[model samples]
Every structure is written in C-alpha cells, then in structure tokens.
Target: MPKVISNTSPILYLYRIGGIQWFSKLFDEVWVPEAVKNELRAGKIQGYDVPNPADYSWITIVNPKSMPSEWLALDLGIGEIAAMAGN
Candidate 1:
C-alpha cells in the first residue's frame, strides 16, 4: 500500500461520483490538507452534493504549518496552495 497526498479537485470529483473508495484500494492512505476539507464542506453547503470527505477512513486531513511563500504568491485558492505546500 502506498501513501499519497491529494488535492481538492480530484477528491471532489471522486466523492461527487461516489468513487472515493478507490483511494482506499489503491493507497494505504490518502492525505489531504485542511483547505481541501474546507472546500468540500463549502461545496456541500452550496448544493454541490459532495460527499463528506471525512467520512472516508482512508482519507487523512492535515494542517501543514508554513506554506511556501512562492505558492502563496501565485494567488491560488487555499486548496491549491495547501496541496502544493502541504506536501
């Protein structure tokens, strides 16, 4: 089993279609940043019907300290920043 760090979009899409189980089968665990978790929660509130990412036991959410200033300078969304920097 392999461990993988994941971004928001892929997780969102997979959860939207109810395929989140694939992560468990493929990897020992899939790590996500707090930002990604927030994104999913927001999407659900916005009526996107996204599944709760936390419901998946294989998905671990992390809060990384000190994101790269360069990535932050890119003015990307929190999810993107977290994905690149959290890793």
Candidate 2:
C-alpha cells in the first residue's frame, strides 16, 4: 500500500529541488487532493517541473475525493482528509 496523503507544498517544493525522484523512491504512490492538483496546474504555460514525466516516473496524478461536511466552510485544500474520507 502506498502513502495516500501528500500536501501540495511538499510536492511543489520537492519538484523545485529536483527531489521528486526521492519521493517516488520512498513511496509506491502519492495522493493529491483536487485542490492540490488545481494548485499545481494553476498557471498557464508554467513549463515543466521536476515531477514532469521527463524527470520522474511512477508518480501517478489523481484527483482525490472530498470529505463529507454538513457545514459549509472554507476549504483548506488538504490531502490527508482526502485519503481518509475518500474511497
């Protein structure tokens, strides 16, 4: 089983430092919240980052499901919550 909880900042920061390979080496897979993926793909023409196909492999991109919330609140855009609450 892979670690299904990852935040956008660590992912992005690792990408910037060319350590995404390290992440792949450590974990069989990673999880990205919809909000996190949105943050990753936010800018147009952002060019290739470290996690790009050319740089690393085995890191699959996925849109993790949202949690159940009765009360309408500001979304924090998290991954652990996604993995815990998701299928």
Candidate 3:
C-alpha cells in the first residue's frame, strides 16, 4: 500500500461525485495539508457542498514545517503549495 498527499480539488470533486470512499480503497493513507482543509472549510462556510476532512476517517490533515522559496515564486494556491511542500 502507498500513501498520498492530496490537494483540495481531487478530494472536493471526488466527494461531489460520491466516490470519496475510493481514496481508502486505493491508498493506505490519504493526507491533506492544513491549507487544503481550510479551503474546504471555507467553501462549506460559503454554503457550497464541500466535504469536511474530519468527517472522513481515512483523511488526515498535516501542516508543512516550512515552504520552499522556489515554490513560493510560482503563482499557486496555498493548498497547492502546501501539498507539494508537505510531500
């Protein structure tokens, strides 16, 4: 079994399609950065249909100790940068 670090979109879309259970089936562990969790929470707060990571036992939230300077230069979302940096 392998572990995976996921960003907001994949989890969000999969959840929307009602296939979120596939994550546990395909991977031993599914990790999401704090930024990703926050993004989902924000969406939910705004009245969007978003899945809360805490609702899923398979999902784990992690925060990167530090971000790389090179990655910071790129125009990417916080969740995207956190996912890459956490990995």
Candidate 4:
C-alpha cells in the first residue's frame, strides 16, 4: 500500500463511528502530522471515542519542518495548516 497522509475531520468521524480499523485495512501505514494528533486529543476531551494517537502502531505522527506564512495567512486551523504544508 502507498503511504497515506490524513487530515483531522475524516479521522474524527471514523473514530467516533468505530470505523477506525478501516484505515488499517486500507493502508499499511497512516501518517498524520502532529497537528492532527493534537486535534484528536481535543476530540477525546470532548468525549469523542478518539483513541490515543500515540498508541496506534500504524499511525505515525510527523512534525512539519516549517509552515509557510501564506498558509498561516489563510487563518486555518493547525490540522489544516499541517495537511496543507505537507506535514
């Protein structure tokens, strides 16, 4: 399977619906930026069924080296910034 980079919303919904395993079935590994993981943490606090992102073996958290000023200028959330910046 090819590498899979994911944003936050899809993950949030999938986790809430108990369909997170679909990620594993579709991809050998899933790469999410640190921002995505942070969003997941926020979801967990909101009583969503978000698993601890670090506990998943197939899910890798990557920190973006740099974020473009242009992307930041868009005023998007961290998860959007990370995904757009190719984190």
- Residues 4-79 of candidate 2: C-alpha lDDT, one tens digit per residue: 4566667778778867666767777765555555556653246645243323456455654556673225455554
- What digit string (tens of lDDT, one per residue) describes model 1 on residues 1-87? 888888788887887787878888999978899898898899888888776767887788988777867776786888888877765
Which lDDT tens digits does candidate 3 get at residues 1-50? 99999999999999999999999999999999999999999998999999
1 Cα displacement, candidate 4 (Å) = 1.2
Stretch of 10 with least lDDT, candidate 4? 47-56
TM-score of 3: 0.95
Rank order by lDDT, top first? 3, 4, 1, 2
For candidate 1, give the lDDT of residue 54.
76
What TM-score against the true fold does each predicted structure earn? 0.87, 0.59, 0.95, 0.82
Clashes of each: 0, 0, 0, 0
Clashing pairs in 2: none
Better of 1 and 4 by lDDT: 4
Better of 2 and 4 by TM-score: 4
Candidate 4 lDDT over 23-69, as tens digits, reads 98999878889999998898788986777778878899898888888
Best by TM-score: 3
Arranged by TM-score with the best first, the candidates are 3, 1, 4, 2
